[model samples]
Target: MKRLLTILLLTLCVNLSAQTLRKYSNEFMNIGVDAAALGMSNAVTAFSSDVNSGYWNPAGLVNMEDKQLALMHASYFANIANYDYAAFAMPLDHDSAIGISLIRFAVDDILNTTELIDSEGNINYDRISKFSTADYGVTFSYSRRLPIDGFNYGVNAKVIRRVIGKFANSWGFGLDAGVQFESKNNWKFGLMARDITTTFNAWSIDKEEFAKVQDAVEGQNQELPETTELTIPKLQFGIAKKFIYRHDFSILTEVDLNIRFEQNNDLISTSVASINPAFGFEVGYIDMVYLRGGVGNFQNELQIDNSEKIGFQPSIGIGFKYNCIQVDYAFTDIGDQSVALYSNVFSLKIDFDCFR
Candidate 1:
């Protein structure tokens, strides 16, 4: 009860302290194409799998061995170049792994035109179409176990870029820090600090002349241009437990309490953070096949706000394992304003156990 109360108090404080909500950043675009299956469904952390361990819980890299490497690619739920991402992790020695990820969100071709007044009112002409704005990010990560027992940590540095025709282009940096722990009984605790830096020169405001026209209409000589900076969330706390049922069957569940703070201010803000509960089980009487299903919230690419929604994202997956190699695939629903789309998540992971 005390733990629960502490959580409630933290949440209340977060909500009351925030003054304004943040707008979108390039990082959100790729987050929509969250692959690694269980990571999306359960708000995954401290859950260790060779492939997604790079993105979800870096500390899980402690589980990697045999000079292992895992790669995953999510095709994205929508075909509109919304959100797509790919990640890979390679382990060396004990408690150490190297990871990399790439993400992109492209706004498909959009007609660029200006209103033209003709004799019969206003007629729009083919003003030539250019690819809509796009955002991309690349991440490199490293993780290791600490000298303390049952403790491990990781960090990631990312390069972010935004492109919007000839109008807006910017480059920036972001950082991530994560920690994880596992008890003898298999309980898990995890925390991650995400996008802790400010990416600068996020947009182009060379259209000062247009602003002047608008200012003339508004009767003001000066107009404050929108801030051309991208804001990213600060923290995410995650927890989960693994239940090994029978000899070969197992179940996993997790939750994440995401918190965001105001840029350049001490204020903070939060929402329920959406609850993503996932379940998985093994198939085949011999435990060679794995089946997975889950639900959770995923960001939208076009929308500037990383709003939270519930009961909308769902996933189903299947996996096959032989020797030390595993191949897995998952189908996910991508919800949107107009129509919800679908995507495929494919992963490959190789594991080795010295004691086995």
Candidate 2:
């Protein structure tokens, strides 16, 4: 039965990959939720050791020494959207941990307009409306240290929901798995498989209401259809090393490689160009003040026009920790030359065990 389940999971992933093609579904899942992780260009697969580890690599949850609660918020695309996350984690036993997290991404106060016009050719301002679009996800994660000295394994189950005003909505389910290994020399290696079960979203549309609006508007032929969308699986591998100097200062560096399998004319390409790589470095002083920087999303061709091209996205962040409370901030470049296009993330965490 175990082998049969594995086969079914692989088949589902392949089918989802074929259906998604070049498009990404449930893309909000890709957004980094932790300010500290974002500051490191999301290269924390092997460097996870905090509350947010549940989102990066569930196996890393085992590294926490006590119960933790964390909260984060970010503004994206010039304040057009807001993203927020919250999580709590606790050790279940000597060798195992459990965590739960919630994520919300939303765009509010959007102007909704229909073409219900008067016979006098004047636009009816009263017919205009306002609505909001939002996406939400909740994840439950569990991790355990394996019998092997420095090995750990973890899994995450997630439920997702998306709403577009009152016109359409979708619900989805997905699973993720991860493993981590630590060497005696303090080197860490991590592997994560996201959407291993082929995340599936079933969308329901209000076609009757949509049809009424279409009829009110002249020359409108758009129709709504109920459909299901899939989010393909993605794999990530990472390595990290840390250096401690005289117990007063420490430096850590990590690199992560991400792989996405997409079908091109029914062929899968595992070439170098298809792999996305991210790099990060962190410096800590007296375990209080921290500085971080990294680069990622190396796009070969990000064209503003026919001649203008941009390269990879870069990020920097700072952190401070005092007692059981920690605060982190990160700034990410979103590829636009305009300053308004940048994103900012802020996070706070508290550990209850500090007082124990």
Candidate 3:
């Protein structure tokens, strides 16, 4: 029974990974909720210092000295899907902070179809059904600055839930840890371990629900099966340097490396293992307005013309800050123009202490 369960879990993980455009299970956890991070191609492991750090690198939360609230929303594939996030952070002391965050991704109003024929030999459209699919997560985080200056560490505990209409559902749990280091010269380094303990999702299916649909169809040969999925751990490393001039203008450049332990056939030929790299740049003017851009997800692909091409995704974004409120926008190109290929994200952040 143990071996059978393991095989079933692996199979489920592979299917979910394929459907979610990720190399591992629980791909929704990999989505960046901060517009600032997405606009910078998710190279903010060392640069996230706001409330959204709860989702990026919890260690960055130690940099927050004021209570903050942040909210973000994104439309994927031209509104075919939606992603939303919210976070709140508060300092427990001079060197410690706590945070809570929520993330949700959903695809709604999907039409369910059947192939039952009427007496006139025509397909019946009378009994159409609709359903939605959604993924949700809640995270609790804590960060503390070490007694040694310029160093910080943090951890996040999360609960995840997913539902496909009412036919199937899952419950998952995971842990993440991160560390950040800054140098006197302003260079920064960061490391994050996502799903450090291997996230597990136990799924239960309503066979009766699927059975009804199968009965509606003329010829069905498959039955619904319940299973579990496991998301393996991944490590991210980042380094960044900032150039400041005239005390009014600054440019920050960062790079990140993503290491995955799962076997990826697409990247096998390129190296013995899969290692994805990302790069980002941000230009700030007096801390009021900012411009950002980045590229990531390097892959080798074959073109329709029988040519080899290296594929990468690019993103751009802008941000504005006034008083204690900040607004950000980002546009990402996911390489598919035909089917919801572009993603637009917007975020707002407020610092309550700034008013005082």
Which candidate leads the pack in TM-score?
A: 3
lDDT of 2: 0.80
Q: Summarize candidate 3's per-residue lDDT along 170-273 as a digit string, tens digits.
A: 89899999999999988999999999888877777767665545555445435454366677788889999999979999999999988887555233333445
Top model number, lDDT: 3
lDDT of 1 by residue, 1-356 (tens): 22422332232222222323344444453253334443245466656545455566566665666445555565444565565566667676676878777777776574433222244555546533343657778778888888988888888787877665443456767677788988888778888777666443344433642332332232333333453455555566777786666777766666665555533211122253332233323233245677666655433333337553333466667778787777777776635322446766676766654325
Worst 10 residues of 2 by lDDT: 264-273
- Per-candidate TM-score against the hidden true structure: 0.67, 0.86, 0.87
In model 1, residue pairs whose N, Cα or C atoms come closer than 3 Å (at least 3 residues apart or on different chains), thus clashing, are none
Clashes of 3: 1
For model 2, residues 270-319, the per-residue Cα lDDT tens digits are: 53325778999999999999999998876555356755443577889999
Task: State candidate 3's TM-score.
Answer: 0.87
Better of 2 and 3 by lDDT: 3
The runs of at least 3 residues in candidate 2 whose Cα sits more than 4 Å from the true structure, single-residue gaps closed, are 1-22, 115-126, 212-220, 263-273, 302-310, 334-340
For candidate 3, the per-residue lDDT at 315 reads 90
Model 2 residue 262 CA deviation in Å: 2.6
* Candidate 1 lDDT (Cα, 0 to 1): 0.56
1 or 2, greater by lDDT: 2
